[model samples]
Target: MPARYCQDSPDAIASCVLEDMVLLYHRPSGQTHMAIAPVPEILATLDDGAALTAGELLGQLAQLYDLGEPEEALPLVEAHLAELAALGLVRIA
Candidate 1:
């Protein structure tokens, strides 16, 4: 099976939109992250607490945004998920 990712916890982070940026405050780490575009959208998609593969996430996002080609977006989504995982914002499940 492909790797699956889930957000750390709904309570672990607090977020708000400022202009075009999404500001995320991670309570556990007391750190804030500024995100743009699909980062914020990715976090929001994970907010439902579903563990999803990059392909699954791309499908969900495709419903809400015109991401062009899924083939192109898959790697980008995977990269974003990996980055989020490294930041402790998300975890592999």
Candidate 2:
């Protein structure tokens, strides 16, 4: 399970209004880079530079996608995370 970068729109994903988004980038040589989205200037209360973890990311997904609980979202999140990591989108943190 690896992340496949949408070559057509590598940087088109939007970030949160109050939080930063994490992205895993895969290079042709089979390496992954974790690219954290920077908070937009217009967005307030998003100054912290801390990177989001899997659990935290699940929470974000729960909120953004209106899921009921982090537990429920955890599996999906983990799957995607693992996929991304496998494809050199990110490394397990």
List the candidate 2 regions with Cα displacement exceeding 4 Å.
1-25, 28-50
Task: Provide the lowest-lDDT 10-residue window in model 1.
Answer: 7-16
Total clashing pairs in model 2: 4
lDDT winner: 1
Question: Runs in model 1 with CA error above 4 Å?
Answer: none
Per-residue lDDT over 1-82 for candidate 2, one digit per residue giving the tens place of the 0 to 100 score: 4222212223323333323544333335434344342112211111133245556655554554565666776665666656
lDDT of 1: 0.93
For candidate 2, report its TM-score.
Answer: 0.44
**lDDT scores of the candidates, listed in order:** 0.93, 0.40
| Candidate 1 residue-wise lDDT, 6-92, digit = tens | 986789989999999999998988999999999989988999999999999999999999999999989999999999999999999
